[model samples]
Target: MPVARLSPATLSAVRVTLPGLGVIAVAVALSLAVNRLVPAVSPLTGAVVLGVLVGNLPVLPESARPGLKWATRRFLRAGVVLLGVQLSVAQVLQLGGGMLLVVLVTVLTTFFGTVLLGRLLGLPRGLTLMVSTGFSICGASAVAAVEGIVEREESEVATAVGLVTLFGSVSMLVLPLLADGVELGMWAGASVHEVAQVVAAASPAGAAAVAAAVVVKLSRVVLLAPLAAGLSIAERRRRPAAEGGRPPLIPLFVLGFLAMVVVRSTELFPEAWVPMTKDVTGLLLAGALFGLGSGVRVRSLAKTGPKALVLGLGSTLLVTLVAYTGVRLLG
Candidate 1:
């Protein structure tokens, strides 16, 4: 009897990719559980930690590497694109002119400032770029988005992820204690690394603070595509003149993200579905981060030196001071 046979190409692709993807799926599930139980670190952040632990502990099977690579590149990009569903043009504009300026200035300053500091500290350009995105934008999501623009070793990516997650989580505890209500909210919205961390930090103040912080942080989130596109352009320009290739003004996935933002602005999606969409987006992002995390070598990242650490601390301080100044000036 004759039996159906899988094509060699298809079979080979699946053999290489499926195992790592399955591992990522499990990591995402674990992340969700941690999110529910712990409620401090974000599921995406948790997933990265989980991946790091698995990766550095000698448990990572070689068979899963191909899928991990696929997830880090493809899944991360797709997740960032889908994240746009949670934002809207109107939502950002409603923060008022002063708050808008604050968000814009904070992101730009933190981004460029970190890169310059990285140069001064002699950190690798690619690692600095990744860390800059994490600090200037929306933490891991921003790191994942910028990953498309700056090609680098996964170890660098992992290092950036670790720094942001550590600082972001710390801020959740420390920021609230520094101020109350609107003051704390403004500070956090403008300064905190991730949306989840912003919420956690600001919620202690009040619901009103949470509302303000979420809006402010989302404004930062809105900056992701533009910043990424700017990097892509700059990178293309910096290439040797002989290369002669002009990159797209925006990545296709970034364009998709912008489209999702527009769709969201129209308010066509049912309000009821927004929460569910956010959950799905978080899951996708978590799975991607887990894959990225599995590539981390803790010892290798350590050898890259304390320069990246200084950069992270400096970036964090820069944003915090800038955000506080904005809060005072704008008020």
Candidate 2:
């Protein structure tokens, strides 16, 4: 008789991770269903919303934590890296020196300006950094990437995610209603929090607008690696040896992101691979967001309500103004 069975340790590991993984899997499925039924809502955003519902209503169980951690850490990083597959250096370069400058100035001003504003408003640096990153760069995905660098609380992550959802949706709807609205796809692509939001905001402008917005948005995305690396360096220095050992100069995941960008730029991958890669990246990110959302404590999030609302509003306004200005002048 020949038999094959799992090792004891392997089975133990599965036992530890499975419950959380199960929950994440189910959340993702439901999120996807919601998105399918409501085409206006992105599955990734739906994942976080559903996760918040699950965590808050039923209360996420302790036993599910290990898998949640695994999902957020591994899946999130992989998704971020794969995001590069959608971009090429040439796409960004097409924006020309002026439009590229608009993208750069907008990102830098929004990020730093939000940080300074948060400090003045007495918000925690972690919350500010995450929120600013979300507003400045790529939304929830950027917040997730920087979470590892700054080691923020899950509640803070939820709050940052909340603001991204709130203002991003507003921008998505409002941007298309403006004068030269569709043309402002460059502005939407520059300022809106999520890529999905940018696409939604710009898509009505036609394929050309969508194309312009995406290229500009992806340029902002390319900033993630450097911003994260710089933050990681500062964070590693700030912590004492007693608190933790020094981390890599740049997080490995960030490096992986850069590598993917290079792969895409070189045209090493077939054009046909683009859609498949985007789908995979979207799924992975949605899963990670669900995991993060499961950790939220709403009451804690409320503690920062007034200040957070103000900060979120301000950040949104700041980015919008900057992006609008940049695009008007340069674009």
TM of each candidate vs. truth: 0.92, 0.94
C-alpha lDDT of candidate 2 relative to the true structure: 0.87
Task: Indicate the worst ten consecutive residues by lDDT in candidate 1.
Answer: 240-249
lDDT tens digits, residue span 1-331, model 2: 9799999999999999999998888888898898889765777778887887788886678899898887787999999899889888888898899989998999999999999999999998899999999899999889888887886777898888888988999998888888344457788889989988898889888888888888889999999989999988988898877886666689999999999889988857888999999999888999999888877878887899899989999999999999998888888
Which residue pairs collide in model 2, if any?
A: none
Candidate lDDT (C-alpha), each: 0.87, 0.87
**Candidate 1 overall Cα lDDT vs. reference?**
0.87
lDDT value, residue 22 of candidate 2 = 88
lDDT digits (tens) for residues 108-162 of candidate 1: 9999999999999988888999999999999989988887577578788888988
Error of 2 at 280 (Å): 1.2
Measure candidate 1: CA RMSD. 2.8
Cα displacement (Å) at residue 155, model 1: 1.0
